[model samples]
Target chain A: MLMILDYIKEKAEFINQALAETMDQLEGVPPVLKESMKYSLLAGGKRIRPVLVLATVEALNGDEEKALPFACAIEMIHTYSLIHDDLPSMDNDDYRRGQLTNHKKFGESTAILAGDALLTEAFGLMAAGAKNAHLPLDVALTIIEEGARCAGSRGMIAGQIYDLQSENKKISLAQLEQIHRLKTGDLIAFSVRTGAHIAGASQRTLQALTEFAYGLGLAFQIQDDILDVIGDQEKLGKPVGSDQEKNKATYPALLGLDEAKRKLSVCIEEAKGKIREHDEIRPARLLEIADYLLSRDW
Target chain B: MLMILDYIKEKAEFINQALAETMDQLEGVPPVLKESMKYSLLAGGKRIRPVLVLATVEALNGDEEKALPFACAIEMIHTYSLIHDDLPSMDNDDYRRGQLTNHKKFGESTAILAGDALLTEAFGLMAAGAKNAHLPLDVALTIIEEGARCAGSRGMIAGQIYDLQSENKKISLAQLEQIHRLKTGDLIAFSVRTGAHIAGASQRTLQALTEFAYGLGLAFQIQDDILDVIGDQEKLGKPVGSDQEKNKATYPALLGLDEAKRKLSVCIEEAKGKIREHDEIRPARLLEIADYLLSRDW
Candidate 1:
């Protein structure tokens, strides 16, 4: 357990440093824009997505150095989505990760531009990083295509729109699952797939990882729903019951708490089973990460 | 003039068709999201940016078909910027291109997502297009990097932040020029550069086109400011004097109308001179395009 924790800490530190250096070295950008973007970017999330990228690469015995930029780029996309979702017109979030939301800290317009700039710069970083890392162009292009698809209209954005529309409405469990799968699941899946692809994993490995990712994503979301109902505010970094206040459809809200927990256990086990079946790849860290999510309070 | 008009019309039609086809062929995206994106994307603009791309490629005798996706992607970025700019929290415009603005027609949240989706999908289209066209990975990566840089924090977004800041304030001529150059000029310059780079032009050709694009971009903005002051509302699509209403510092507002016209003329001359100096490349059409900008009302 200590080893897994140390591994996560080391990888997180590496990613955080790369992210900061990338921002510090960026030139020609306006100071205000940089500040606004950096505020949310470095706001100290758990760095789960980027860690997954590095972990997957490591699990496949790939060079983690070459995958660093893609990891950072995914983090940027994640940060940008959070910024936009916190906007007054969208979620109207007053606080995120225990700090004032982007629009609350910066003005709304600047927040919007900050989000735009982060999303745009993510692509630039990927392309430039691929060039620098000497990653094959075809592989780089495919990864970028997958990144855009996961983050765009057909994936995360679609989930966001659905989530917004579902606000104050009583949506079914299946619909809730669909929304979570698209809104957050696709990007999470993409992160794992990207790491594997970069490592030159075989088709069998990719397929197993894909299944593992899908289950892990759903389990992650279920735990999030459960946390909203029972999480400590200091630990969770936001007010509890916000989902209930918004009347948003979530697993614990739709399913009974016990049933939701059961479902989460099922997902975590299924996800672990996929990883365990691929023992030749030694993805023990991924299984540990999945278990951590299952038990995480924040 | 007739030849130039015909050239613009032919190229615009080609671009419009390609843009429409791309939208139609996009799979798995939500219908409402697609509708919202398509509304703004297909709105009748002059298609100036994409046309420059095709025109530059034609001048260099490059494969226009191979450059088609890139041209379309730039247009997507342009459309996304417009959608975000017209948001209620931003410009608060009720109309664009003589139609209801994206947020006004589609609602704010969807409009925001639509903008995000379009911007993200543009990168995907570029990567996929490069793969399909068998464009060298390095070239494709460079082009994508340039596209992101031009449209990101250091370029278009920077200009937007500056423009927003300068609202209702007196800005200097140089300051106004800087804003426009970053906001509109970088992307336009990128359009020409991408076309030329795709054609594998010489370093000298690239440098000349870079200068030409800078001059042309500034001239285009100056003409736009001139039109805002003295042009007809019917031809211009939106109302006139909106800049004055907002107290925005435009070229004509900073430099008097006559001086702005003089600046425009100088820009046109300088831009045309660069192309004409490289007459061995037979860039007469580019020269005509510059002249057309010098006289265009919309």
Candidate 2:
């Protein structure tokens, strides 16, 4: 257990360094725009998605250096989504990570451009990823296509659209599940699937990992909704009751808080069970992530 | 000459149809989001960039069918930029091509996401471009990388930042050129060069085409500034003198209208001279475009 925890810590540090280096490349951009991108990217958050990519690749016996570019790419896409989602026209939050949101600090126009810049750069990084992987061009292109699809309209953006439209309206549990699947689950699934795909994991292993991630992603979001409704603001690093204040429909809103927590526990159990099917030596980090996601108070 | 013009028109029509068909593939997206993307993409501009790409590829004896995906991808990137630029916080224009801007019709958040969707989808198209081209993965990845770089921060977005910062400020001709080179020239050069690169045009030809596009792009922007200063709103289909209203520094702002026109004339001449160096027919369509751009009353 200590070894697993130490492994995660070390992987987190490596991914964080890669992300910082990728962002530093943007310094060659116009100073104002570069500053705007750097401000949000470096604002400090748990580097979970990148760590997942790195860990998934390693679990599949893939080269870590080859996966590094993609690890950075997924995080950039995730960061850009956050910047846009927090805009005044969207969730309208004033702070993220206890720091001013991009729009608040840089103004709306710059913030919008910063997000645009980051999103475009993410593609650049992905294209560069192929070269890093030293895989055949076809393989790299496949990975990129899958990742971009997971991040785009058919995926995360669709999730966000449904989320926004569902606000202040009555929605069913199925609808909420659909939203969470796309909004949160798809990218998480993509992280694992892409890592496996790039590392040339076998079909069975890739399928297993994807199923595991889907449940894990759902459980993670459910826990997040539960935390938002009942967790302390200082610990969460943002205000509580925000979803309710905005009339945003969440798992806790559709299902009672107790029911939502129970559902999350089920999801975590299922995710763990799927991970258990893998070789005993592998999926250790994924198992830990599933457990931590459900157990964390924040 | 008339036959060549007819040929170009036929190719443009074919490319336009392909673009529409590629976009129509975005069908399964939520109705509202799909509408947002199609609203701008199908809004019917001249389709000049994509046409240039197809023409350049065909002129180099490359498969036009193979290049169609890239043609569509460039247009998507172009449309996404227009959508974002027209936002209330950016250029803040209410009209484009005689229609309400995306933000004006769809609201800011939708417009923002719509732009993001288009940008993300563009990579998907480019990744798919490799399949269409049946080329080596390395070549296809290079096309995507170069295209993204041209459109992203070190390219178009950076150009926009400088343009926004220079508003109402005294700036020199060199500074204005730098802004236009990035904002307008980079993408145009990409359109021409990417096509040539994909077609396996000789390095000499690609270099000539790039130089030609650099001048043509600058000339295009200078003409646009000139039109804004004196063109009719009714004919242009958008308000004139917007630059003056926004205090945007332009060619006319740096040089008198007469000198700006002279500079346009020189650029047109230089662009034509470069194209004339090519062995295949002198790109008469491009020359016509240069003339139309510099001489348009609107």
Q: List candidate 2 stretches off by more than 4 Å.
A: A1-5, A279-281, B1-8, B279-284
Candidate 2: tens digits of C-alpha lDDT, residues A37-153: 888877766667777888888777888788888888888888889899999888899988778999999999899999999899988988877875677776788777887688888
Writing each residue's lDDT as its tens digit, candidate 1 over A1-298 gives 4577787888899999999999987899899999999999998888889999998998899988989999999999999999999898899889888899999999999999999999999999999999998888778999999999999998999999999988998888888889988998999999999999899888899888988988999999999999999999889888998988988888988888999999999999999899886754777899889988898889
Model 2, residue B225: what's the lDDT? 95
TM-scores of the models, in the given order?
Answer: 0.98, 0.96
lDDT of 1 by residue, B141-214 (tens): 99999998999999999999999988988888889989999999999999999998888788899889988999
Worst lDDT 10-window in candidate 1 chain B: B275-284
lDDT of 2 at A199: 82
lDDT of each: 0.91, 0.84
What is the Å distance of residue B264 in model 1 from its true position?
0.5
Q: Provide interface RMSD per model, one decimal.
A: 0.7, 1.4
- Expressed as tens digits, the lDDT of each residue in B211-271 for candidate 2 is 9889989998998899999898877778998998988888887798999989999989999
- Binned by DockQ into CAPRI classes (incorrect, acceptable, medium, high), candidate 1 is high
